[model samples]
Target chain A: MSEFDEGTAVVRRPDEAVDSSVFDTELDKGWQIGGGINGGLLLSLAARSIGEHFAAARGLHPYPVSVSGYYVSASRPGPAELRVETVRAARSHSTGQASLLQADDEGRTLERLRVLAHFGDLARADEDVRTSATPPKLPPVEQCVGTEHAPPEFLASANMLERIDLRLDPAYVGWALGKPSGEGRIQGWFRLADGREPDPLSLLFALDALPPVTFDLGLFGWTPTVELTAHIRALPAPGWLRITHSTRNLAGGYLEEDCEIWDSRDRLVAQSRQLAVVPR
Target chain B: MSEFDEGTAVVRRPDEAVDSSVFDTELDKGWQIGGGINGGLLLSLAARSIGEHFAAARGLHPYPVSVSGYYVSASRPGPAELRVETVRAARSHSTGQASLLQADDEGRTLERLRVLAHFGDLARADEDVRTSATPPKLPPVEQCVGTEHAPPEFLASANMLERIDLRLDPAYVGWALGKPSGEGRIQGWFRLADGREPDPLSLLFALDALPPVTFDLGLFGWTPTVELTAHIRALPAPGWLRITHSTRNLAGGYLEEDCEIWDSRDRLVAQSRQLAVVPR
Candidate 1:
């Protein structure tokens, strides 16, 4: 098998200009919903390209402290071009906008995704404040139910289910059985299918890897994300990442979900908030 | 006082090209923090500009569903140019990037703020989901303690205190007396000093108008925001808006806070999440 056989192909560099690169959406095919790539994977691809640009252009090892992505259009499989524009470069932080585009038959570039990311040094410690929120209680990863062996119903419908190792908390798996918990919360362990070590970029995918928390409230189907913002609190340790997702309000044909990611060490690694359209 | 005396001046249009406009930051003088305008005010200005652009260019009444702002530099109080670029104009939503820039003596514009915002229609209603979160309990606006009459201690140091009418939940006010509740939560009522009706645009300012919830955790001083994202859930009713702010994790010299706004009818209006440098 090729080295880029799995999701790593999403970050494979191209022989293009310094500010641009090409990505293959083949690895992301399994994650597709409603005939389009998952929004989380598209966001991660844009972030990976922007991070590379920050490193090559400004010599900054940028861990995205905050990333806001607007899903302009659905990204299709095949080749896509990522264009990066440096909005501002400072000593400690740099801000940039990256666009994921595809070429039409006439070679006109069409935008599929746009993201704004803020990069900072995660290791730089000045003054630290103790965290007040602790990770939620969950069964060990081994004891949890992995999606790899999900029911034929979900597997037959969602090919993306096989791309990652998602061990959902047993208490919340009722949704898979057509019995939702009636609560907008989910907690579980998540890791990429290819077993790459978790990093800031991977955290982007991890944050959105789970199905919409609204699904537990009997709102099912493809709840596409309108916009998503993720904040990196600390660099994650190498192991299964614990994710706690909850939604406070669902109103006016829209809902917002907030997620907190904790490393195996119980360190808060990242927090994300997203606005999505409620399922019909 | 002229017609542009109050909050209306914050949205003053510039008679320039469709892509650019100018803003007088003098209207923001009262909201200063550490000799510069508060980051929230700057974000609101950017949102206002982008909203206007969406309205003019696409004929859509753009309420910001998601806004991400990176405070690249401290904005000086004066006239600055707000340049808007339409990133993508879709059928129901339009995404845009706006930069707030300050010009030098020679008219070379220097960028001070960069923002990406997703605008959606506030009037469009589709299938709705029930909200699970409730607004915090607080005294009536008439009985609550307004910042207008704050003790000389806080009022003397924070010049921004006088520009907004904030009624703190008395239970959580011990921090003002150097007695912290040991919890990172703050509930309050907010409205403009000039008594403007609270709209989707004004809700942006109200979300960040209060002091950081970290202050309740015994941390103080200017906790500058590195990035902020706010989601507009519903249009607010005309009355004092209820705000509930809380923090989950504060570590590695950074912290994240979440805020929820509710109109007088007890309906959720907007929700915001921000990442800021921890107070030293």
Candidate 2:
């Protein structure tokens, strides 16, 4: 199995309460982007737990239609607990909240991340309507620059690069070469290195997998994501997914990054927006 | 005080529990869009409750930096209760959850909307960094078409038109005139009809004040928002706010609308994205 599959896998535990369920997972090494596990991976764990919780209970809504998550604190590699609370399980859709927690040095349960997601059946969803939507234009994976071209120091901590194959459009990565582009845009292709097909759950990771768009504008340092929201538009077919990230406003020490992802079939599969602070 | 000030105003009550505070507000008439109250106005109530909760408890963070909300059920003009829970209180920032509830016919509290928001002091935010960001070019409000031209039928249920002054870019509203633009873009200027100055709280309404972008695609019917997320970039500088709403992806019975709001000074004040289902 791919390292990502193992890393994000969660083991369901007995119910903590009538409306809440608990899941345990190890925050394995090699996913660190800075000093903490990748925000996308943490989100995926939450999504997985929610998916499992609903599958076992209702078996009606299996796909996550929309999810919003807030990063409370940095989580390190260790055993973590994700407590899933069933907020509302309606006939059409279900809404749930998942809080990823870990023990601090003092043995206090620290909240790492909290997420609220809505689940529905995509197969029962309306088909693509005729509209102006189109896949992002990008050079094929072979023509795009791989992480091997990233600064060695950056690649050192971005161990996620080892698990997920990411390729960037040459135009948006001038900062990596010591010359910043100032465009505040990044385009790339992503896929699990071991070839595990992308699914709705993993699309959460893919939506946030790209290097912070600020990197293209020449900013460095950790820009912790304050809040990230993702909408899964459709299920993905196999193969690489094209992604484009752009930032139009950076003010008040905060920046918003918008990402659009399209599957190999040229279908717009997912969209995400994240609020992150610009490094001071 | 303007209707907006009164409409969004929340009166804080004693704590419902230790970590939870309750606020009461009348949904008020003149804000119904389709069959329920405007989503933006409902979100404003949630933001207001969070603001008041933190101010009374810790006076540390007064502005909502980011907020994500799920519309559980439709709410009408009536008395509603917003329960605010302190999620985490940190030195730098705070997170809170607010659930807007209204009693059903059976007297059970029905969850109408729930939101998670991050609060921080915007005054301490970093100065605007140099980047490729600018406001949308819009004709002066006077030259744009106002709600007077909307089909009388739409303007009937859209009493929100009476409360919010919305001026649309003519090119994007052909559908209103029965031409159907098919561009899926809507640009306009927004301000309260009573001339209430815009603030961080009102910006939440401004971010979602315009007609759904799907209207430009010639589709009609209530497109319920499954999820909406907004980021308050900077406090507004009063006057009319230039707003642009666009949708590039509409598939699987759902559409994603992206909105960007700029203050009268052309400063991007807030941005939002919402996922809504296209009418069947």
Candidate 3:
């Protein structure tokens, strides 16, 4: 099994004592970045817990169509628990909220991530009627710079890079050479090293897998995400996913970064927007 | 008081047994569109509830910085109840989840909207260091088409227009003459008719106050928003705000529309993205 699959595995906990369901999972170190767990990985764990709750309840909605997560605190590698409560279940869709919690250094259970998700079956989606969205032009994957070869300082904090293959557009990687592009944009091709196929749940991880767009703007420090919302528009076809992340506005110590992902079939599979603090 | 202020007024409900805080508010007819309460108004109510929750608890974070709301069902103009639960209260920011519930025809309490909001003190924000964002080019307010005089069919359902002044860019309002530019974009100037200025709270309503961007694509039918996430980057200046909504991808019976709000000082105040079903 891929490391991602193993890392995000969750087991339902016996929960007759509480109104909501609880699940336990172990956060692994393979997904750590900047001495903290990847935000996407934490989000995926919350998504998995929600999916498990719906499955055990035999709910008709199985796929996460839209989910918004707020990062309450930094997560570390350890045993964590997720508590999910169903908000509502309608004929067409279901909504739930999940909280990923872990024990801090003081042995206090801290809520690290909180997610509100809407689930539905994507197989029932209508066929595409029109699309003006076109894929961004990029050189062949071979010509692009592999993120595994990123600057040594970046690689020091980006331990998650070892689990996947991310090739960035050459034009946007000038920062790696000590000459930043200052474009506030990053485009890349993403795929798992073990050839694991991307699913709706895993797409949450991929949506935020790339380096921060601020890196290209000459601000090479960490830009922690404050809140992120992802929409799964369609299921993906098996292959490399083309991704682009860009920020248009930076003000009052906050910036909004937008991302779009297209599958191998050239279909828009996912879209996400995140609010992050501008690195000081 | 402005109709908007009157419409979204919320009073704390006395609840001694419940675990969450509940507030009662009336959904006024002045904000109805297409026989449904405006999504922005519903979101504003949720934000207000969160703010009230923080204030009542004496939390330091008084302003909502990031909020994501999922529209569960269409809401009608009437009495609605908002129940807010504190997710996590941190030193820098506090998080809360709220559900806006209303009684259905069968007297069942149906969840209409669910929101997760992050609150912080905006006055403590850092000064703007750099920004690549620019306001969209627009004609003077007088030269633009006032949305109150929109196409009769659109006006029929857009009663909210009477409470706010929305002047659309003439180049994008060709749909009113049966000649849409097919550009899938809408830009406008927005402000309350009473000349009331926008604050961080009211900016939530203004984020989604304009007509659907799909209208410029000649899709005149209603486009129901499935989920919307808005980030309050800064407080707006006391003047007309420039707003633009546009869609880049439309597929699988869904589309993602993005909106940017710029204050009169040309500072980006708010940004939002919504997932909506395409009109059939």
Candidate 4:
């Protein structure tokens, strides 16, 4: 498999002039295809980009904060424009959204997301914490991914899921991956690696692709994301992204979803959820 | 406190020339307020109403399969108007979005949610059955709702919340009532009074109003929501809405978020998460 170029890791703004040469018909399917970023990957990157914009607007460091959720509606691909809008910026937290539109080879605004972001706001008085359960533990990551038990390798290959290693937590054992890096309910470590250093925003781009395994409960085995969301608990580490998520299957073929993130130290990082369509 | 007249759990829809009295008086605020129900609450009811409509359209039980995250932009409150359009509907799942609008009796569009919904398809898969972990033991209901550990009576007095009770899982053994739901992680039980028939939509309405108890890891506190989302996993059986969530602190005060939901049988019910404004 071709490796992600080491140089592509630098934060590239959507508004920046991108070479149409990077656009490949073959990439219409590549994770970083159109304009060199696949829809899913682009969705994640767009979210991180929005977060970064929010931070830069406020002159906050550690760069962009995090993502709440991301959606990618489609038209034909190419010349798509992603516009970031800062919704609200608070002391402990901030909020922003991005609209990624697919214009026909030229620029026509086909589909978009008002992508959203959030961060820790320290403005209020610390209230009593309601989260108290230790993150459920899980088996080794080796048991799930890279194993015979996993679905077709093509599934993993298609996801191009970067920097995440999941293991079912032995406790609730509910899709627990590993630990995050904060001081709240969530506890996991995360970082993006395309052979470059990952900023807080880049790490999140990688985090938003995985679905809560618990949603698998209703799986006769079809998974399609009608919508996707992420709640970053804390800024992640620099090499790998680890987390645990559980999904609740509703009566019909639909799923209302939720996923929580923890920093590596078992500190509360970010929590998130979404509603999705079960591909029939 | 007066009880919600459980007479007919139906909304006075516009088609029937229903009473528009409650929605009068447009209030300019981040939230749209109706005399009887808030925007969040109305959205839930509307989903149910539309869900049934889809079911009737397809000759099904009008099963609500899922909901895209709830998006609430700023709006003026007055006699509100909602318009719903089906995105795609199939025998398995029906999906659609609705727009909620309000004008000062002048037919101006206040806010729109292209709210998407999915219904009728539910999956039951093994391989991921992690329900072995029982809901942790916690104190009885009375103690939790009446203590200083919770927001004092008035702030907590919203009538819609009266029928629900939440408690900290003793396994985590938290003090100060407990930590609020974190960014992508949340935990707790919620349900209507025992014996009340369970309505997937009603549970959903509650889910929408759910407040993420995210605390500031940097300052340790709670933040307001710019947006909230809910996902349904399984059909609930008139039980408590067990929930868990966490947060990610970001630059310029922004973040990404996620959350999960469950029923009394400890069955995975649904999940939700959102990007919210965590104020400093």
Candidate 5:
């Protein structure tokens, strides 16, 4: 794993029992867009904390099957506490609600983020059903344009892009070049910059890592997410992950984007849907 | 609006503040599937209560943009109270968390359902970006098969079907006729059985009202939903909502389904994604 990956895997110091797990970590500025931490990075941090707690306490490997997070306040790049509370624990699955809180100097805690997630056993296997959808076809990674080589203005401003390696499908490079495709869609390959094998937790970040598909429709600038839900279908295999983000309608000041992530083996590993606001 | 729509629109008794709103109503037996109230119907009830509260208290017509619900316990058909608590109210949107709780003989309350929803103003409008995806082509409602006319065994046991009108796309009728298509997809048109004009709240029910798409992949029995998120793009235009439900992969004992709802004008009104357990 890269140094950034190691930095993000900060361990949480449990308070007392497994029911409530607490962690304090310094938000890496590298994960910030503008002054606040990227929402997907925060989600990944929360998922990792909760997943570890469940795995340790229940002796069951808790693979995040579904996670929905509502951003209550902007998460700044500083000290933050993630408190995960177990809501329910059943034989087959477990549910947890977590809050990323920022405290004031007076020691009063304020919620910055909230998430509800369900975890199921990742080791469990199932019979494969015939699938009609195929993995998106894209050129080799070397042929795609990496965000690292993006314009100086974008690379300098979008600090979060520096933390992860993202390569855009050649067909979508026009959007980054200020040419609106008029198609609200983006396809790309992504992986942790530190060479960490993609896991369910990483999938959480990957689901929302893409620039809002709305950008391709000629709307740009902070497309704040209202709520995001991701379903992890399978544990991703090692190597880069391919993702396709697309939007169907942009109306009522809100647009919905659906993302599909395919693993190295060309298996569909995760799917996500989110509602986001267009920049004013 | 029809009697059923009126009945479903139970009034909430607020406690003199915008923070909390309460409503008590009997869980309609017609909304039950195998004894538990339908998850989507419960979501609709919560959204209605929260929407009403926000409208009356803040003068904001907070239509649901996104709603994610995690069923904590099986909601039985009986009296229940829905308590909606304001999570945050911003200038452009408001967030609320709600719980459908049941009280035992001793007045001990138990949470049966929990939901987090973001509401955007129905009065707000924005310039539409061009959309590339079109509504699915399906047979007219008159030519399609209705679930009400299903086999006696299915009709007798599936009580929830009686509460809504669902007309299956002709291409998928073979699945209902016992032929597994090996394709996990279903397209249909849906609306309230009572002929109420389809609204944002009703769209919530319509999102999950269909049978689990996993059934088409030869995986049968109860495929209980783990988490469901729906994004309302535009308000429906008072007619049967066209919906297409499809699944990409069924692996790791779980599967993800995506649903798109289009108004009569062929405009996409809402989109939904959910993770559900495949029957063991």
Candidate 6:
């Protein structure tokens, strides 16, 4: 019996001392409330930092800023590193490239990312643009929730999506979900199950998880995001991350997915685009 | 002249051809380089098909799979009208969506995409992969290709980038014929003087272009794509489409690009990605 935050996990055991092998040492620390860091966590961390960099560079603070796009390339884990290089710095908008490196013990590059961001230009809101219908809203996290399933694969997922406050908003809200395979288009909401603030890379890794929810049988637990790109519209306050993903229209077994992230304010925070092939 | 194969445009005088405003009116009737009716031309037609419906349905495709990303909600022009609907035709691998609309005065969906694709059950290329410094071995279409004042507010972009064939093999070969203005990252062996195929979009179009190269800029004109997710190993053929693009490292301005498409033989088709700023 422990207390939990709205979006964070509540660790109930730490001293239980579970037997661990290769994955036990660093992970078992906060068994009762661990959500510290993992692959997705790093991505989210990276995203946050990159977003902040843009917000400041573009003077887009106070007002929300969205993530324009993200490309997460897969690699074996190693030393965590982030290299941010600017693309353009303008009076109104600013763009840059960020790469995160997770190197092996030998200092070799493993996985990394190159993120693109546009900041300070809220001017588009004034332009004659049509915002996509708000994805059907979801039951507040307070309504209902699910417990965590710590499968070996989940652990292997690098904690990117370790703790998610997920729900399929409403009926007909999505094409893919906890039902028959959909036409690939999906819609839903997500948040840190533990409510812990994850980094940008961490968020990206977690996002890599969402698009494959329908494709992965949840059996072997191997969902590889060959390539992932995200576009951000806003950086919502940490809590829940809303999203919609689809792949059903997959051609050549090859498919692509576009996802958007939203905050409670209804402001679009980020968009994710991905290309993956489900192995038959 | 050398024999033009499929996908090659059949040149015709402006008056000798149908009105250009009417799409599919044959801007240039070229050899049939498509499967029945699928090819780059058809895909472009299908892409500009239904801006609203597809945006509404939010469907994704994985076959003949489009490499378009970066979408800016724009007003439909007076070309024709279209309505894209994602339909699950009775097919496998090729299971995909279609739209119905008019490419002419009759508001009809003259174009639709049928996919014949299934996820490759084949194992991913071995984890131990490698990339070729061998580079794409293709001569640039000319000393300078691409267009200079193509039209519209494409901005700073000179000739269609038909200037040079960028090389990444053996060593990175880069040659930009003009000095463009924009505080960001730019790369690739762009050509000029508009002497190559008239592409529809580049990977980084702010105009609704998708990926493998999900980019940020408004995809306004024709831009080729080259490069891909990366390599644990070199490709089957680093043909002419093989090109390399990076932020080239940004400082005060930006640093980003998107995907660079390459020919099966590794010739540089187009390179995309993006860049941003860091401020001093």
Clashes of each: 1, 1, 0, 147, 1, 167
Q: Write the per-residue lDDT of candidate 2 for residues A1-280, one digit (tens) a residue.
A: 7777798899988654656788999998788888899999998889989988887677779998899999999999899998898778889899989999999999999899989999999878777666577777787788888878776666778888888889998878888888878888999899988899999988998888888888887787778999999999888999999999998878888888889888988888888999998976
Scored against the native two-chain complex, candidate 3 gets a DockQ of 0.73
DockQ of each: 0.68, 0.72, 0.73, 0.13, 0.60, 0.03
What's the DockQ of model 1? 0.68
Higher-scoring candidate on DockQ, 2 or 6 = 2
Q: Residue-wise lDDT of candidate 4 within A113-214, one digit each (tens)?
A: 445454443323244343444553534444433311234432444434443343333333232233221111222333333444433444444444443343
Chain B TM-scores across candidates: 0.88, 0.96, 0.97, 0.67, 0.92, 0.27
lDDT of 3: 0.87
Cα lDDT computed for each candidate against the true fold: 0.76, 0.87, 0.87, 0.43, 0.79, 0.33
Model 3 chain B worst lDDT window (10 residues): B12-21
Tens digits of lDDT, candidate 5, A78-152: 788888878778887888888788876787877777888888777675755546668999899988888664445
Off by over 4 Å in 1: A1-31, A105-107, A148-157, B1-27, B104-108, B148-157
Q: Rank the candidates by TM-score, best first.
A: 2, 3, 5, 1, 4, 6
> What is the lDDT for B226 in model 3?
86
Candidate 4 residue A119 C-alpha distance from true site, Å? 8.6
Question: Considering only N, C-alpha and C atoms within 3 Å, which residue pairs clash in candidate 5?
Answer: A2-A194
| lDDT value, residue A240 of candidate 1 | 87
> For candidate 6, what is the DockQ-based docking class?
incorrect
Instruction: Compose the digit string of candidate 1's lDDT tens values, residues A218-264.
Output: 66666778889988888889988899899878888888888889998
Q: What is the lDDT of residue B162 in candidate 5?
A: 71
User: Which pairs clash in the backbone of model 2?
Assistant: A126-B253
Candidate 1, residue B254: how far the Cα is off, in Å: 0.6
Q: Which scores higher on lDDT, 1 or 3?
A: 3
